[model samples]
Target: MSLRTRLQGRFQLMAAALVTVVQLPPVLWLCWLTRTPLPALAALGVSWPYLKQLQSPWTTTPRAPSTYVALGWWSACLVFDVLMLPALLAIRAGTPADATWGLAGAVALLLGGDAVLGRPRLRRRTVRIAGLPPELDGYRIGQLSDVHCGPHVPEEKVAGWVSRLNGLGLDLVTVTGDLITHGSSHVEAVARALGGLRAKDGAYVSMGNHDYFTDGEQLVRELERNGLHVLRNRGVVVRRGEARLYVAGVDDTWTSRHDLSRALAARPEGSPTVLLAHDPDLFPQAVERGVELTLSGHTHGGQLGVPGIRRLSLARVITEWTAGLYRRGRSWLYVNRGAGTTGPPVRLGAPPELAVITLRRE
Candidate 1:
């Protein structure tokens, strides 16, 4: 091979190896950490690095999309270990002990129990939001978030969700990014699946971090082609009779390229505006700009639990307003539990959710 060709091949190999390391090594350590009654010290040693690895989703050479949901389970198992080990160890050892048999037991339960019993659950929520205006009261907006469509996400399930969204009789349907996993891989399929969803105003979306990681622009067009009106750093005014509701969306903040200012730049004055941001962290900017309602779905509401042992899961850290409606002074933020899973395909306390949100002038 020529020198340049050899160099190119080497680059490909390195990239492939890095992806595999990111996706596989922690998983092996996690299995070992939970398989035995490891001490607290060993527990910590095994888990800390796994925690870091979860943030990077690539595994294998060039990160091939697995046909099964094993990675998703693997991801959730690690999260479970993080929450369960510390407490169970503290209880079993009668104090905060080092990685010991007790600690290992807890870690194992988190990893194994969820793997065995956990099922992907979906929740449909409807809320009649009050206190908008006479004209804008009773505006129904269907919200779908975090539909990370790819390998493990059953194709029929996705198409079903879109059908359900359409049945809600919504004035508008909004997606807050994460519509697909490998954005270019199955986003077009997702678009086709969602081709049935129709709302009066339109369908809108904001880009999520995962979408940016994959192919974002193509995903956007695919959704548009499916008749879902997606918005990215843009706004559109919808008129329901005499009422006007300005809907805008901001790109994900974690990817560090979100421009909130631009997203709301075209927001209409004297209109009840709703911001559809993929990540809840953008609420501050929305509140500062006097946005009324902001919808989000990045956190999965502590995806798993041990039934009363842990109050909530570590998924909470991904968003301050993890999985509920919170009012930041004059602005309201509703973080959806999400329509799909990220790493682990299992969900526990926080069920995957779709929302039929209505706006009313209180």
Candidate 2:
């Protein structure tokens, strides 16, 4: 192999090995940290030493390995507050501390609330456009993101989400990429799931990091084949009511290597613009290009974060609005919490979400 190829191969090997090493320590530490006394159970042999050590009746309840693992994670987080406090404190010198408390207040605020409330607090955010074209009134855009389909996929569950989207009665639907976990095998199912959607403008789609890792070109072809507009650095002049709106889509932050110029190239001059990008971090360019609003989803709100405030540090590399609408001067951006999971199946403080953006005249 060439030197560069050999080095890359070695680095990948090291990365895989390091992941295993880094993840093992926590299990070892938690087991060694060793909470409470144990009483022998006869159900399955002598049983694990730490099984009875759990303080929660729920954690100790007989359940599947996944359930035990889930409870074990929550319990470990509860017990390990002292460990996470320092990091939170250090980071908060620049940001608010209550948000840290919000994240760290796992037992009472998160787990307790999740159990008691049984639902997340959602906000219906509305923004008025002063410069919006006169003909466009009640212009609605629906967006879904990060629907990473794979093994153990709740197709029916996802179908429910799709059904909810259809109920919104939106003017248009858009996706912020990561349609499948690895490839296009089940993309047709997703198309069918979202196929029932009736939009005056039609559906638009983009590519994400996972799409590149999977088969991006194939996805674009398939989605286009299924009647979804796959915008790869392209723009379409969509007529909303009597007004004109430029709906543009950029290549994903990681995959298509986005270029706003190419996306806006085909747009009519001086038309109100809305950009559909996979990462909301592309706001500055969209703003510079006179985009009035942008829609995105990639962070999944850390997928393991605190509510109300964001988990930017947890996802350190992505945009700031983990799962909400944010404004930077004249530009507005809505970042979805995402519709699926990656790495782990649990969504703690965050939920899979679909965003409805309604633009009204001033």
lDDT of 2 by residue, 6-98 (tens): 534543454344233323445445555665222111211222322333222111123356544544454344334423554455466466666
Residue-level lDDT of model 1, residues 162-259, one tens digit each, is: 88888768888888877776535676777788667788777777788767645677777877887777777888888877767888888767556678
What ranges in model 1 sit over 4 Å off? 1-131, 305-311
TM-score of each: 0.69, 0.72
Model 2 ranges off by over 4 Å? 1-30, 33-106, 112-123, 311-313
Query: What's the alpha carbon RMSD for model 2?
Result: 9.2
Per-prediction tally of clashes: 23, 0
| Cα shift from native, residue 2, model 2 (Å) | 11
Task: Supply candidate 2's per-residue lDDT for 340.
Answer: 80
